[model samples]
Target: MDLNLRKAILSNVSGHNTEQLEATIVDAVQNGEEKMLPGLGVLFEMIWKEASEDEKQEMLETLEQSLQHNQVQ
Candidate 1:
């Protein structure tokens, strides 16, 4: 994503409370726009950076399962 786009997402996200942010992310993912995936990557990176070892392992397992499910479809 371009810097401007990243900034825009951050700005929009900053304006929202936690629930709204979650809803926005869910809506974005369901929309399935190609650009959204990179944004999701950025979100994942942020979360991973702060996550504990167990949380990271769980997330990786979940991601692997999601990828496998997508591949089967």
Candidate 2:
């Protein structure tokens, strides 16, 4: 059984408007389910592919801050 998670995730959300996509992300994050991580990674992969170098740097910085904050706890 070959399950292509990336393609499946994209297919499920293809053609979604910005609001719809935002809602999906919000729901998944707020739910905090481990099963949602892969889907979020796939979505982030798509964003990474489309992001400019500056955008990528911003994302890295934001992630770094988040991790550092957690480390302080």
Candidate 3:
């Protein structure tokens, strides 16, 4: 059987509005489950694909700052 996990994830959240999407992301992060990672990755991929160059640069800067500030276990 051929499985497309990204497509499946996209399909699941296809019709969600901003509020619903924010809730999904909040729940996933709050729950901190490994299984939720792929869904988050899919969401990030969607954002990355849609972002403009300046937006992408800002996101990268934010990510870099976050990584620099956060402590790893």
Candidate 4:
């Protein structure tokens, strides 16, 4: 069985509005289920593809700061 997870995820969210998408992301993150990781990754991939260079750099910096600040000492 060949399952295209990315395509599936995109299809699931195809017609979602901003609020719907935000709810989906919040639900996924708050649920903290391992199964939700792939969906989050798919969402991030779409964002990365559409992001401008400046937006991408901001995202990178924010992520870096988050990881650094939350690091386990």
Candidate 5:
């Protein structure tokens, strides 16, 4: 996403509490609307960048397992 769009999303979400954030994410995922993906991707990227090595490894493992399970299904 462009910097401007990212900034706008961050600005909009800046004051949201944990419950609100979780609801937003759940809604985004359940809706499967393409427009929401970029914003969520940006959020994930920011968190991924700051994760510890062990945390990153764990996430990678979990993602791999998810992918594998999806493929099987």
Candidate 6:
């Protein structure tokens, strides 16, 4: 069996506009299900691929701060 999860996810949301995409992300995060992580990862991969170097740097900084804050708890 050949399975392409990323392609499947992208296809599922292909026509979604910004608002719909935002709602999907918010719902997924709020639901906090283990099954949603792969979809999130696929979305992150798309963002990372499209982001400029400076944008990527800013995202990394944000992620680092989040990780650091988590460690302090």
Comparison by TM-score, 3 against 6, better one: 3
Q: Judge candidate 1 against the unseen true structure and give its global Cα lDDT, from 0 to 1.
A: 0.79
Q: Please report the TM-score between candidate 6 and the true structure.
A: 0.93
Sliding window of 10 residues with minimal summed lDDT for model 1: 1-10
lDDT of 2 by residue, 1-73 (tens): 9999889999999999999999999999999999999989999999999999999999999999999889964
Instruction: List model 4 lDDT by residue over 1-73, tens digit each.
Output: 9999999999999999999999999999999999999999999999999999999999999999999999998
TM-scores of the candidates in the order shown: 0.75, 0.93, 0.94, 0.96, 0.86, 0.93
- In candidate 3 the C-alpha lDDT for residue 62 amounts to 98
Query: Alpha-carbon error at 36 in model 3, in Å?
Result: 0.5
Count clashes in each candidate, considering only residues at least 3 apart in sequence or on different chains: 0, 0, 0, 0, 0, 0
Would you list the clashing residue pairs of candidate 1? none
The per-prediction CA RMSD against the true structure, in angstroms, equals 2.7, 1.2, 1.0, 0.7, 2.5, 1.3
How well does candidate 3 match the true structure in TM-score terms?
0.94
Error of 1 at 31 (Å): 0.9
Residue 37's lDDT in candidate 4: 98
Error of 4 at 36 (Å): 0.3
lDDT of 6 by residue, 6-67 (tens): 99999989999999999989999999999999999999999999999999999999999999
Summed over model 4, clashes come to: 0
TM-score, prediction 2 = 0.93
Candidate 5 regions exceeding 4 Å error are 1-3
- Candidate 4 CA-lDDT value: 0.99
Local distance difference test scores for all models? 0.79, 0.95, 0.97, 0.99, 0.89, 0.95
For model 5, how does the per-residue alpha-carbon lDDT over 1-73 read when each residue is reduced to its tens digit?
A: 3468878878878889999989989999999999999889877887899999999999999999999889963
User: Which parts of model 2 have CA positions greater than 4 angstroms off?
Assistant: none
